[model samples]
Target: MDLEKRHEPPLRQTPEGCLAVAIRIPVRIVVLVLVVPVRMVWDALVVVGRFLRDTVFRPLGRALSWLARAVFVWPLVALWRYGVVPVGKALGWLGKVLLVIPLTWLYRQVLTPLGHALVSMLAWLYARVLTPVGRAVAWFLRGTGLVLAAIAGGVYAVVAWLARYLLVVPGRWVYEWILAPVGRLIAWCARGVLWVLEMLFDGIGTALYWIGRVLFVLPALALWRWVLVPVGRVLAVVGREVWDALGHAWRVAGRISLAVGRALATLFRWVFVEPVRWAYRTVLTPVGHVVRDVLVRPVAAVARSAGRAAREALAAARESVRQARADFRRMLLGEPRRVEALDRREPTGPETRTLGSSTTALTKD
Candidate 1:
């Protein structure tokens, strides 16, 4: 009987049965979760109300009572202490003055400095912004003026063009008509002046011509008279001398004439040859000297200087070639040998690897 009962009771739960029980438990837990929040909020509201009544409302009620008494009595106390009693008023005044004076001084000093800095910043801003605005306004005004001037110029050009095209002929005609009589009068006056000047010039020329003829004739007559007188005296003297000399001593006379001819020739030679020699020496010789000294010598000096410059330039070229040759030899041969001697050293770390690699790859290329 016990064995049969145990076997019957051992009814094992199936997977579907267990799943159904698990689903029912979740439904109950969901119901409890929805209800618990509402319950918790209600409890919390009740607790808060109780706390407010105990801690805040009772204290506030007592404070109001006390504050009503103090408000009713405090003004009279303040009046007795500050207004009527006046106890240690001087000390209070000193304290107030000390506090107020320092506060006022601090306001004046620190606040004034800060205010000045703010004002300066504002002024700088004004300068940066407003000044340019003002200048822009002025520039706009100037542009407006330029536009007005251009407009005026255009108007003036149009007016002038119109005047020339429409009114110029009439204006010229009026001007000609108004000035014609005056121009004729001026021309007549100018002609009269020219006629008067011509007559005056003709009279002057006639006077000058007659005076010149008289002067020339008078001088010629005087010269002829004076020469003829001298000639007559000389001829009479010469005839007497010729008769006496020829009769007494014809041979002596011939000798005297020959002597006189030789003496005159000597005198002419002395006067003309000496003066010509002196003039040649003084004028031609000095001119030749000046040409040689001033013109020819300076030209020769310039030529010599040019020749010297050419020679110096050729020498300098030679010197430069020598220097270049010396430098080339030094650079190509001398410097290389010196560098090779200095470079005679053990291989550096990088150079050794390069040399080993070069040896290994010597035939690769």
Candidate 2:
């Protein structure tokens, strides 16, 4: 298995050189050194930004949003809800009363009758006045068309006789007897001349093609194959290796930056966070507890007690006032009669039913 694995083809990779190897270490080192401080500062800025967002900016945003709503949105909403909506409704009612009702009445009483009368008048005019004029015009155009058609037939006959004798007969005789022989002779001579020219041009083109091939095409091919291809290959390899090196260096720098960031974070946690947390826990927490227990709790308890007593006194006074009002009302109007409830929930009456005391026709006590 080991031999087979060793014999197996390796993965295909672009070749690298000593130059790439030489560049990699220095570039990564320089990038790491440059990135560490930036990463630390970035992390610090990120932390501060988060702290500000949570503590300051969030509350400010909420307050600003509330203020904006109170200042702008709420007033607009109130105007729309209270002013615009009521006015719109009133306008709609007025439109319905003033415009809609009046227009509807006018349309029904005035316009509809007027439209019917106009339609009748138009129908009468079209039937009585315009129809006969149109019929006469059509008849006149029909008679004129028939007369023009007869005149056109006579003109066409004269033109056809003149064309056949003077133009068609003479042209046919010239084409068949004289022009035909001359045209055939000219075509035959042109064919022979074209053939000779074609052969001559073919020979010239072949010679030129071979000359150009030897002069330009073969040399260009040789240059492209031998010179440009090798040079381009070398350039492509160098470019690819340089790009790969940059990517590898950037990744290495990112790792270094992460390590430095973590180290700084640990240092900050120990130096600043731990001490502050310790002070808050050891000193401030106990002080806060003492203040809350000694001053705040007692004051809160006293306030709560006073408030409860005040509420009780107010409730008692309200009850007394209510009773006095009731007594005075009773003195003026006497006591009101109380109605008895008629709805019952029980199946039997006050006493439980027994067989001996049954009130049915079958059994009675």
Candidate 3:
């Protein structure tokens, strides 16, 4: 049994030994069978991806980028640098040579000479024709004015003499002969009438005086002597008593009126003035403030907003009208459109009608 045991391997009995056996078998199978092929496939894919990125895709991207630069960027740069810039410079030179130089030359050489000639001609005309005519006309007008003034002065003097002889002299004669005598006669009659009236007034006054003396003065003296003395004594005593009573009553009435007036003034101050002041302070003033803040200020703001809106609307309308007018002027002056329809293959029948309508509209505008 010892010899057999030494020849045979040791047998395991625990779960740890069993677990090790199971893990070793699978690890060998996975490493040998599955992991080797998988590693190979992954390495191949990496090689292919690297080859594509480095060789194929890189070259393609570089070629595409070069083509884009040549086609788009290089052409634009060349056009701006060489074609557009040179063409613009050439056009500027041509404009200077054709338009500016010619216009300047015309202004300096032709127009200036023509203006000088015209001025010389006008000066000659003034010297030859207008000066003599103007001088003669001024002389004639001055002579005519002098003659007219002399004639007017003589006529005025004659008229003044004639008026003095005809109207003033005759008026004076009439006043002295007819009016003066009539005035004197009327004065004499007035004097006689006044003297007669004076005598009649004196007689009436004297008679009235004698009648008053007889009828009133003597009776008044007799009444005074006989009856007034006794009556005066009795009336004096009664008048004294009545005067004292009236003075007392007047004093009492005045004091009552003053007291009543003071009471009325105090009542009016409390009822009318104080209440009015309180209402103004508490109610009316606050109401005024509320109205200002809420109603009046808002209304003013609305009005301002409406005004601004109206102004903006008016400005927009004016801009639109100005643009329309500019377009109309361009049309009338045969200016080209901003963008041309270059894609059209041919003109159709509608183009003719549209052209005719456009011409008519331009004419109308």
Top-lDDT candidate index = 2
Tens digits of per-residue lDDT, candidate 3, 1-365, equal 77666566779875544434444544444444444444445555776799899999999999999999999999999999999999999999999999999999999999999999999999999999999999999999998999899999999999999999999999999999999999999999999999999999999999999999999999999999889976886566445545544454445444554565567779999999999999999999999999999999999999999999999999999999999999999889877668866855554675544544543456644
Q: Report model 1's TM-score to 2 decimal places.
A: 0.21
Q: How many pairs of residues collide in each model?
A: 0, 0, 0
CA lDDT, every model vs. true structure:
0.77, 0.88, 0.81
Q: Which residue pairs in model 3 clash with each other?
A: none
How well is each residue in 37-77 modelled by candidate 2, as lDDT tens digits?
A: 66566666888899999999999999999999999999999
Q: What TM-score would every model get versus the actual structure?
A: 0.21, 0.56, 0.25
Error of 1 at 22 (Å): 99
* Highest TM-score against the true fold, candidate: 2
Q: What is the lDDT of candidate 1?
A: 0.77
Error of 1 at 277 (Å): 54
lDDT per residue, candidate 1, 227-324, as tens digits? 87778766665555444433444444445555655787799888898889998999999999999999999999999999999999999999999999
* Clashing residue pairs in candidate 1 (N, C-alpha, C atoms within 3 angstroms): none
Residue 91 in candidate 1, Cα distance off native in Å: 73
